[model samples]
Every structure is written in structure tokens, then in C-alpha cells.
Target: MATESFLREIGGKSVVEQIVDNVTNAIINGELKPGDKIPTENELCTSMGVGRNSVREAIKILEAYGVLTIKRAEGTFVKQGFDSKMLYPVLYGIILQKDSANQIIELRKVIDVGILQLAIDKLELESLHKAEQAMQKLEQKLAAPAVDINAIFEADTAFHMVLVAITQNALLEGICSYVDQITKKSRLKAIEKFINDKATERFLLMHRDMLRVVKEKDRAKINEVVEKHYQYWEQVTC
Candidate 1:
């Protein structure tokens, strides 16, 4: 069984990525349940024919993403219940890192517009308020003498996620989680390059404008701002 599933021929992916997928798929298929202990490192390497490094690296990634928990003396056990947090590392390792930032920018446009429409349909006043608060957090980060890239990204991401949350669409939120990870990774690099550029300030203002439009529930303007926002990132990131 391990030979069939875990020892499959490696495709384009690295061994660590393949191992992550194999383990994730096993969990998804119900073959490995929550709280179930996975095979030992030696057992996995022997079964999958991967080196110890690959197995160790794959297990490390899974642990970081909350997929598997390691006990000091005992072996790793599958985490109880599904966490949305688990999906992004798997996605980043397997899909997004392999793809270009341009693809992410394009996807952001489509996803954000759909998210805005759903939020508009619901017209939740509280969502607008939360988005405004998130925008303020981003503004504060941007206005600081020194830029903390992670804080800016967290604030920016929180604003978008808040908007998406208003839609009450579980599937959209999950997809956004993957996108969020990809965007944050890219943003970290981009901010390093553009630290002195005044574009950073305008970027903060762009989100502020977006929040203002959401308060007005202006569909046309919301779409317009979202389009420009993602397009700007694609250009700058490159």
C-alpha cells in the first residue's frame, strides 16, 4: 500500500513536495485520520525510497502548517479537525511558488470582484466598519518611520479577508487563504525592493479609497479600485 501511494514515480515536483502531497492526500482520503500517527522517518524513507532529508523536510513543513504534531518521545500524529491554515503551506509548496506572480495578480482581480459583489449583495454594515478599521491599521503601518513588511501585509490581507468574510462564502475564503500566502510572500520581496518608493504610501491610500467605496456600497468604484490595486502589484513585483 505504501509502495503504491507513497513510492509513486516523482513527477515535476521535488521529493519534499511530492511527499507532502502524498501525506495530504492520504489524510484527505480518510486513510489517515485525525490523531493517527504517521510512519517513522526510517519507515517512510524505506517505503517511499526518498532520502532522510526529504522526509524530514516534508514533515517539518507539515508540522509548521498544523497538519501534524510531534510529541517529544512519541511519533507525529495527525492534527484533530481540519484547519484552513493547513491548506496554504501545501498550496505554496506545491502550486503557487511554482507559478508566477503575474498569475496571482490576475487571480486576485477575479476573486476580489466576485468577493465584492457578494459582500455588496449582503450589504453588511459591520463588514464595512471592519474593513475601515483594517485600512486604518494598514495606514498606521505605512505611516511609521520604518516599514515592517509583515505588518503591512497582515493589515492589507486582513482588510481583504474581512471583505471576503462578508460574503459568507466558505469556498471563497479558503481559496483566498492560498492566494493570501502567495501574495504575502511576494509582498515581502517587493517591499524590500520598493522601500523608499512613495508608491507604498499610495498603496495604503488605495485601500483606504476602497474602504470608502465599500461604505458607499458603490459597486462600480469598488471594482475599479480592486482592478487597479492588483494590477499595480503585478507591475511593481516584477
Candidate 2:
């Protein structure tokens, strides 16, 4: 495949940025693809009419973003499949934005609803069993004589993770993982509030509702259940 079209000369200021844009565009346009080796540093410099330093910097940035992987002595290649590192750029972007908390809530709702729909369509008995076990563990944690907030948090995370796993879609799971990290603090706050308000059963019941929705394959109730699930989270975060 001819590389000249996609690797055209990148001119003007912010040479490194331009180079990065060029490579990303190629990937988006299918000129480049996952696992495909990118041009050598010298080739990039020559093709983009940029300095070797600029090309090297662009390559390093892409590698850090998980867009490109550098293998020993083999050269840089477009990364194949999902990389947790890829989430960092997006994670930081959202974190740094003003008034991002509410936006994150909305984002979570959208992702959860979509995930629930997918899980319902692809439901399996084993996955349903795991979700049940997760709920049981959560209940046991809540029912302890001295409720452990940390334990509850872990159990809560596990239950939701099992829901995401039910979809059997790796990309959705990865995105959900990203959302989990971003919302970690707010979710803990919400859980703490539920405990302080003596609403542990309510919390458990919300999760039970999720399991019930999944078990019944009730697509109509997904939005309602997800909204209820994030109630305390919205209250505390907002």
C-alpha cells in the first residue's frame, strides 16, 4: 500500500501536533489499521517534511496514548484492540473540564442503559448466576454487625462489573471500567450516604431490581432501574 497519500507533508507551527493528526487521520480513514507498522522515524520526518525531533515526539505521544506500540527492534505499530491506557487521555480530559460531574452522571446513565440492553440480548445462565452471587455478597456485607464501608464499596463495584460482563462485549466493559474510575469518589460518597441514612436495604433492593430486570429480560425497565441505581450518586455529586 502506498503511504505517500496519508503521510503527506505536515507544515506550519505545532509540527508535532500536525504529525499526530496525520497518523490518527490515517487510522480513521483506514489508510492505517490495527497492528500495522507505522513509517520509520526517518521516513516520517522525510514524508512529513518535518524535523526528526518532531516526528520522534509525535510518535512518543501516540505511544503514550496507546495509539501506537513500540516493539523492540521491530518499530512502532498501531495498537490492536482495547488498551486501558487509551482511557487515560479521555479520563483526564473529562476530569479537567469545568462542570464535568453532572456530565459524567449523564454519561454513566447512557452507558449503563446501553449495556443493560446488550446484556439482555445476550443473557446466559452462568452470567446470571454470577450476578446473583454478587448480589448475595453485597447483601452479606450490608448485613454485617458493623457494616464496613470499604467492603460495601467493593461489593457494589463487583455487582455492577458482573452486569457489564454479562454483555460479553469487551469494548463496553473497557468503557465501563473507565467510567468506574472516573466516578469512584462520587460513588463511594453515595454509598456512605446510603449507610448513614440507614438505607442499606434500599441500596440492596436497587441492585436486586437490576438483577430482576436482567432476569426478566425487561428492556422497558432498564432506564428506570439505571436511574434509580444512580439516585444517591446524583444527589451527592450534584
Candidate 3:
């Protein structure tokens, strides 16, 4: 693959960044493709008219983000499929933003609504059964004489995870999982508050409402359910 035509000369302040952008653009524009070996560091330098160090740094950054992979014997190639690591950059960027707490809450509401909508359309008997089982586990955890906050939290997370899984979209599941990971601490805090405030039943009901909306295939009730679900989360986060 002669990448000389796709690679362009670089003349900019952020030469390394420009090189990175060039490679990314090439991939996006179909000049480079998944499983296709990229030009060597020296070749990239010659084609892009950049220093070797700059090209090396650009490739390293791309590799770190799961955009490219380097084999010991073979050269660097574009990664072939979805990688959870690919979302780390987005997760970190969102976490670093100013006033991110409120933003995260809003983002979660949107994601939840969207996931529910998708799950409603794609719901299968087997998946729904799995979700019901998750609900049962959550109920038992909440009903325990001496509640384990950690156990409840894990059950709560699993219930929502099953809902997202029902959609059967790997990319969506991956994105939702990472977003959930970002809010893990706040979520645990919110659950603890619920237990301490004697509102564990309310927490369980919120999840039940989610299951109800999905089972009923009630799109109109999604927003209402999602809003109610997040009340505790927003209380703790914001």
C-alpha cells in the first residue's frame, strides 16, 4: 500500500499533533483501513515531511488509544474492531471538564432514555428473563436483614447492565458501561444515602419502574421513569 498519496506535507506549530490528525483523517477517509499496515516511521516522516520523532510520537499516541496496533514482527496496523480502551480518552475528558457533575447527570439521563427505547424495540424473552433474574437478586439484596450496601450496589449495577445488554448493541453497551464506570463512586454514595435515609424500597422501586416501562414498551413513560430514577443520583452528585 503506497501511502504517499494519502500522506501530506506538514507545516504547522503542533507538528506531532498534525501528524496524528493526518493519520486519523486518512483512516476516516478510507485511505487507511482496519488491518491495513501503516507506513513505517521513516516513511511517514518522508511523506509527511515531518521529523522522525514527531511521527513516532504520533503513532505512539494512536497506539495508546487503541486506534493502531504494532506487532513485534509486523508493522503497525489499524485496529480491526471495537476496543473498550478506545473510550478511555472520552471518559477521561468528560471527567476533567468544569461543572461536570451536572453534565454527567444530564448525560446519564439521555443515555438511560435512549437505552430503554432501544431495549423496548429489541427486547427478547430470554433477555427479559435475565433482567427479571437481576431484579430478583436486587430485591433479595435490599430485603436482607442487615443490608450490604456493596452487595446492593453491585446488584443495582447488574440490573442496569442487563437492560443495556438487552439492546444487543456492543458499541452502545461499551459506551454505557464506561459512562457507568465514570459515575461509580457517585452511584455508590447515592445508594448509601438511600439506605441511610430508609429509602431503599424507593431505590428498588425506581429500578422496577424502569423494568415496567421496558416491559410495557411504553416510550411515553420513559422520560418520567428516567427522571425519577436519577433523583437520588442528582441529589448525591449535584
- Which one is best on lDDT? 3
Error of 2 at 48 (Å): 0.9
How far does residue 236 in candidate 3 sit from its true spot (Å)? 1.3
Cα displacement (Å) at residue 128, model 2? 0.8
Q: Considering summed lDDT, which 10 consecutive residues are worst modelled in model 3?
A: 1-10
lDDT of 1 by residue, 1-238 (tens): 2333534555679999998988888888887889988888887888877899999999999998889999988988899965676666546654545455676677778888787777778757677777778778878887889778888778778888888888888768888977777567776666554556657766766777666666677887877788777655675667
Show model 3 residue runs off by greater than 4 Å. Answer: none
Kindly report which residue pairs in candidate 3 clash with one another: none
Please, what is the whole-model Cα lDDT of each candidate in the order they appear? 0.76, 0.87, 0.88
Quote model 2's TM-score. Answer: 0.95
Model 1, residue 6: distance off in Å is 26
TM-score of every candidate relative to the true structure = 0.58, 0.95, 0.94
Model number with the top TM-score = 2
The residue-level lDDT of candidate 2 at 201 comes to: 86
- Give the Cα error of residue 14 in candidate 2, in Å: 1.0
lDDT of 1 at 15: 94
> Candidate 2 residues 156-207, lDDT tens each?
8899899999998877788778888778888889989998998988998999
Which residue segments of model 2 deviate by more than 4 Å? Answer: 1-4
- TM-score: which is higher, 1 or 2? 2
